[model samples]
Target: MGLRTIGGWLQEQHVQLHMGRWLLELDDARAEREFTSYDDVRGLAEGRFALYIGIALTLAYGVVDVLVLDELQLDVSLVRLAVVLLFACAVVVTGRAIWVGRHLQVSSVVLLTVVLLMLGTTLGRAADFPTEYLTTSCTVTLFGAIGLLRLRMHAVLVMAGVYSAVCLSLPGALQGVDALARNVAPTLGLAAIAVVIGFSLEKLRRTDYLRQREVEAEQARSDELLHNVLPAPIARRLRTEPGAIADSAPEVSVLFSDIVGFTPVSEALAPEELVQLLDTMFREFDELCEARGIEKIKTVGDAYMAVAGLPEPDPDHAASLAELALDMQRTLARLSPAWPSPIAMRIGIASGPVVAGVIGRRRFTYDLWGDTVNTASRMESHGRPHRIQVSAATHALLESRYTFSDPQVVDVKGKGPMTTYFLLGSNL
Candidate 1:
C-alpha cells in the first residue's frame, strides 16, 4: 500500500478508537445548556474519589521512590526529599479535596496536583536509571490519576499533553536519539488510550446529566399543569397522597354568573362566534376573580363559577367575591355592545359552609358541593337580567359594608322560601 493511503487508514482507525473528533470540541454552549446538571454529579464524584486516589498514589509512589533508591544504590538526599514533598503534597490535596468537594474548582486543583506529582517524581529519578522505567510510571500516573479524578476531558487533554512533553523530552535532552526513540511510541500509545477513556467517561456523564435535567423539567411542567387544574394546596395534597382530597370550608362565598339571554345569542351567532363570545366574557371574569383573590371554579356553557376563602382561607372572602361580581357586571356592560346583541349577566352569590375537593383520577377537577353551592346556583337561575342576586347568608356579611335591596322572598329549588337581596354597589 502507498504510504499516504496507509497513513489515512491508521488515522481513521485512531479516530474510531478515540470516539471520533477531539475531546472538548463539542458545541460547548449547547452542552452547557443541556448538561448543566453534569457539574453537580461530577463535583460529587471528584469530591468522593479524589481523597482515595490521592492517598493511594501517595503510598504507591512512596514505595516506588524507596525501591528505586535502594536498588540503584543512589541515596540522593534531594530524591528522598522530593518523595517526601510529593507525599506531603498529596496529603494537602486530599484534605483540600475533602474541604472543597462541593466546589467546581476542585477538579482543576486535583488535576494540577497530580501533574505536579508526576513532575517531581520524574525529576527525582536516578541519573543511571532506565528512562523506560520512569516512562511507564509517568504514563500510569497520568492516566490513572485522570480516570480516578474524573477530570473534564479538555483539562485532562491539556495536562496530559504538557506532562507527556516533559517526560518525552527529558530522555532526548539527556541521552540523544536512542533514548527518545525508545520511549516515544509507548508514550503516544498510552496518551491515545487516555484520550479515548477520558472522552468516553465525559460522554457517559453528559448523557446521564441531560436525562436528569429532562426528567426534572417534565416534572415541573406536570406540577404546573396540576396547579392550573386545581388549587395549589389541593394539588400538593393530591400529589402527596393519591386519593380523595376533600376539605370543609366553613365560610366561603360562592359566586355563579350566567350571561343573560344566552339561548337567543347562541342561536343567532355561528358556533365559533358563540364560543368566542363566551370565552371573551369568561376571560374577563377570570381576570376580575384574580384581581379580587378569588378561586374560579369550572365554567358550564355560558355560566362562570368562582369562590372565595377556599383552598386557602380569607376572612374577607364575602367582600372580595362581592367586588369580583361587581367588576364582572361592569366588564360585561362595557364590552357587550361589540357583540351581536348587548350582553348582561345574572350573578348570584351565597356564603356558608361547603365541601370542596378534587374528584376522579383520570380527569381530576376542583369542585364544590353543599347547600351553599346549590343555593348560589339557584339564586343565579332565579335572578333578573343585569341584576346581582345574593342569598341571605351573603347579604348578612355584606349588608353593613355594601348597598343591597330590601329582603325579597324567593322560593329556591330543594330549599323552602328564603330571603334574598339585590347587591347594588359597595357603600365604601
Candidate 2:
C-alpha cells in the first residue's frame, strides 16, 4: 500500500502516548464524534482570523517582490496574486455553508510551503547568494504552522517533511553539496520548535474540551431533577425569577386519590412490601395521568394528586380529570390479584380557580391553595371505597359527557353540607 494511505489511516485512529506526550484522544466512537463536533466549532473563529492575517502577509510580500530588482518579479507577482486571491475567496465564502477545521490547518501549511518553494524556484535559483533564503523560508513556514495555523502534530509533520526533502535535494540540484549542508541544521531546528508548540497547544485544547463536556452533562442532570420536582412551566419561571411563584389558575381540575384501607394494610405488611406496593400503584397512576392530559401534583403517603389545565390551559380540564380517575379504578382492579390485601381507591375531583405555585425554599413543592383544593380533599375523605366522588362544580362540567349517580348532600369539614355525585362511567 502507499505510504500516504497508511499515514492517513493512522491519523484517523486515536493514538495515545505517541513519542511521550501530545496525543490526547478518545477511543470511543461516540466520544470521537462529540469531540469532532466541538473541534469544528472551536476552530472556526481561530482559523478565520489566521486566514485573514495570512492573506494580508501574502499581499505585503508581493509588494516587496516588485520593489526588489529581479527579472522574475512579474512571475513572482502573478503567483503571489493568485495565492492571495484564492485565500481571499476563501475569506469571503468561508463560514457561510463551507467551513474550516483540521483540514484547513493542513491546507494552510501545505499552501504556505508551496508558495515558498514557488518563490525559491523563481528567484532563489541562479542568485549568487546561496541558501540565504532557505533559513528564512523555514522560519516563515514554522510561523504559519505554530502561530498562524496552530496545526496538530500530523499536519506539522507533513509540512516539515516536505520542506526538509526539498532542502536536502534541491541544494545539490541548484547550488552544491555545501549549500545542502548549510540549510540542514536550520530546517530541522525550526521543525522541532513547530511540533513542540503544536503539541502543547493541542493538549491544552483537548483538556478544555473534556471539561466542557462534563459541565454540560452535569447541567442536564440537574435540569432533569428540577423538572421532576415541579411542572416544566413552573420550573422555568422559578429559574428566571428564583423566587416565590404564585400563579392563580382561572379554571383547573384537581384530583386527590387515596388507597382505601391502606393504613391498616401498611401495618400488616413489611416496610419494603408497603413501599413496593405504593410505587407499583402510583407509577401506574402516573402513566394514566400523562396519557389523559393530566399534570401530576405531588403524592402524600398513599395519596396521589394530579391537576389538569394549570400550566397549559386545557379547555376540557374537568372531563380529562374524570377520564383519569376512572382509569385509576380500572388499573387498581387489574392489579388486585398481586396485592397483599384487596385494593380499592377513593378519588375526589373538583374544578374551580385555585392559587398554585412553588412553596418553601428547601425541598420545593408545587402545591395548591384556596377552597377548591380543600373541597377536593374533603370529597376524597368522605368518598366510599371503589367510588369516585366529585364536587358540584366538577359535576357541572362533566355532566353532559359522563354518567353520575343521584346527587347527595354530605357534611364536609371546613364547609357546610355540599352536593356531590359519584362518577359511574362514560356515556358511551
| Deviation from native of the Cα of residue 84 in model 1, angstroms | 8.7
Expressed as tens digits, the lDDT of each residue in 87-195 for candidate 1 is 4565566465554444444455455545544443455354444566566656666676566666667666876676566566654434667655666776777777777
Stretches of candidate 2 off by over 4 Å are 1-22, 66-72, 96-138, 145-150, 166-178
Off by over 4 Å in 1: 1-41, 71-114, 117-122, 125-133, 148-150, 171-178
Q: What does the lDDT come to for candidate 1?
A: 0.71
lDDT of 2 at 211: 60
Indicate the worst ten consecutive residues by lDDT in candidate 2: 1-10
Q: 1-428, model 2: which lDDT tens digit per residue?
A: 22222122234443222343444455554565556556656565566786687678777766655455444455566766776776676666556635345456555665656755654554455332235554464356456646555565666667667666655444443356665456667667766776777777777766676565555555665776898888888888988996589989989999999988888889998999888978998899888877876899988998988999978899999989999998899999998888877978999999999998888989989988888889999989999999999999999998998999999999998798999999999996
TM-score of 2: 0.86
> How many angstroms is residue 269 displaced in model 1 relative to the true structure, after the best TM-score fit?
1.8
Model 1 residue pairs with clashes:
none
